[model samples]
Target: MDILAKERKLLELEKQVEALGNNEAVNKLKSEIEKYKHNEMTKLTAWDRVLLARHQKRPTALDFINYMSPDFIELHGDRLYSDDKSIVGGIGSINGVPFTIVAQQKGKDLENNLERNFAMPHPEGYRKALRLMEQAEKFKRPIITIIDTPGAYPGIGAEERGQGHAIAQNLLKMSEFSVPIISVVIGEGGSGGALALGVANKVLMLENAIYSILSPEGYASILWKDASLAPKAAEVMKLTAYDLEEFEIIDGIIKEPLGGAHYDKRETFKRTKQAIITEYNKLRRLSGTELQYRRTSKIRKFGFFQRFNYDNLGGIKR
Candidate 1:
């Protein structure tokens, strides 16, 4: 069985051990669980991490807010249109330091997933986020964004409402925002939907999270004409936290609990809280112009290239 299965079995065994009042069995199971958790972390492939990021039991943005922030007050609507529930934003305090929190919300079950549009946000969702961000900037509060989405909703209604324009506007505004912004990719960070909230001073990822321009399935379908080749596409895309961190695409990775974040919700929360606080403290030292320059410089450094000599130009005369 896989590590997740083993972990679940251990959890079940522990519960049964409590009922049986067997100390020896409980100690044995605890040791096995610890060993399994440690070993599983080293064995996970990029695709395995991707699956773990999307695990149904994984902690959500709201969960993080509850654990990391002492108090939170959710703000709603784009003001130009209706509220989009898929993206949630609010003002909250962590250790008495206030921040504007913005993040995507995936459903806990099928009914709620449909309600959240499977975390595929609409035009209004982006707009709502930008609005909150703007408010944060006005108050000089730092911005914290949590990304966990498949992509923007590709529905006809969303398109009609100008989805592309909304995302583009956010990219532009966030880049120019004068306050510090910290973004965390908590799960499936796909396409422009993810980028909308991801342009920040410090971009962090959960160790198991995946972030890419598109889903591996979409990439495989487009490039290889085979949706089943998604595993291959995932390997090639460099979407894992370790790969992205190596390339300096993300500022840092918040290490997940052994067996992935889903295996230890409170531990995940603690790690996330600590990572955010550490980064935010660093950013709080920079001036507004410094923050803007750092953000722009960081974004501009994404893709690597080499200068080619004129002699090496193939189609031109020497």
Candidate 2:
């Protein structure tokens, strides 16, 4: 069974055991549940981690912002177009350190999802994020970005507004920013939508999160002409945090609570907060020139590969 299905069955069993009013049975079932969780979490597949990252009850960007910075002041508008609700940018302080926080916000329910376009941002959303980061740079505050998006909106209206240009601008400006930039992948980090805000001195991902150029379904559809083979595609995509860390695509992984972040949100948030702080502490010590150099160097090294000689078998080189 899938992770969600197993979790549902476990919940139902726990409820039934509690309803029986036998303390001994209840205690025994709880212990078994804990054991099950431990075993399952240890062997999660890439697709399993995808499900956990996109869990309905998973903590959203606003949730993390509120928990980490109670006094956050939200800023809106791109100054060039209308404010896009899918992207939320603001100024906040975490542990007394000021930061400009930009996050892609997903709705918790149907209505809210419709309103936020299911976290699929438009060109204006990227512009808004760029504006906030520019402001942060001016004020000499660190910038923190929370990424969780399937991709940028592909609608005609979004394209009419120069969607690609907006994303490109953010990447170029972010690379040159003097202030420290740290990006955390909290969920579905897909396509340029995620990368638009992902140019950072240090990139991190939650243990269960997945970061990829595109979704597994999309990859499967393109390669095999069947979206149903997404699970198989996930195995080949190398999108999991562990895989990305091994590839040096991400700087570190923040451990999630057992089962997923939704299972223990408070603990998850606490760990995420600590990870951000730790990374920031290291970045803060560097000068503006050093920060820029570090960020550009990191970006330049992406997709690097070692050359191999193959002239022994055939006079061909790859």
Candidate with the greatest TM-score versus the true structure: 2
RMSD of each: 3.2, 1.4
| Residues 1-318, model 1: lDDT tens digits | 544566677778667766766578677877776676567566887777778888998988899999998689999999998999999999999988999999999999999888888899999999999999999999999999999999999999999999999999999999998899999999999999999999999999999999999999899999999998887888999999999998899989998877788878999999999999999899999999999999988999889756556766565543
lDDT of 2 by residue, 1-318 (tens): 778887787788778877877688678878897788688677888888988888999999999999999999999999998999999999999999999999999999999999999999999999999999999999999999999999999999999999999999999999999999999999899999999999999999999999999999999999999999998999999999999999899999999988899989999899999999999999999999999999999889989978778898786898
Candidate lDDT (C-alpha), each: 0.90, 0.93
Point out the worst 10-residue segment of candidate 1 by lDDT.
Answer: 309-318
Give per-model TM-scores: 0.90, 0.97
Model 2: residues >4 Å from true position, as ranges?
A: 311-318
Poorly placed runs, candidate 1 (over 4 Å): 1-34, 305-318
Q: Say which candidate scores most in lDDT.
A: 2
TM-score of 1: 0.90
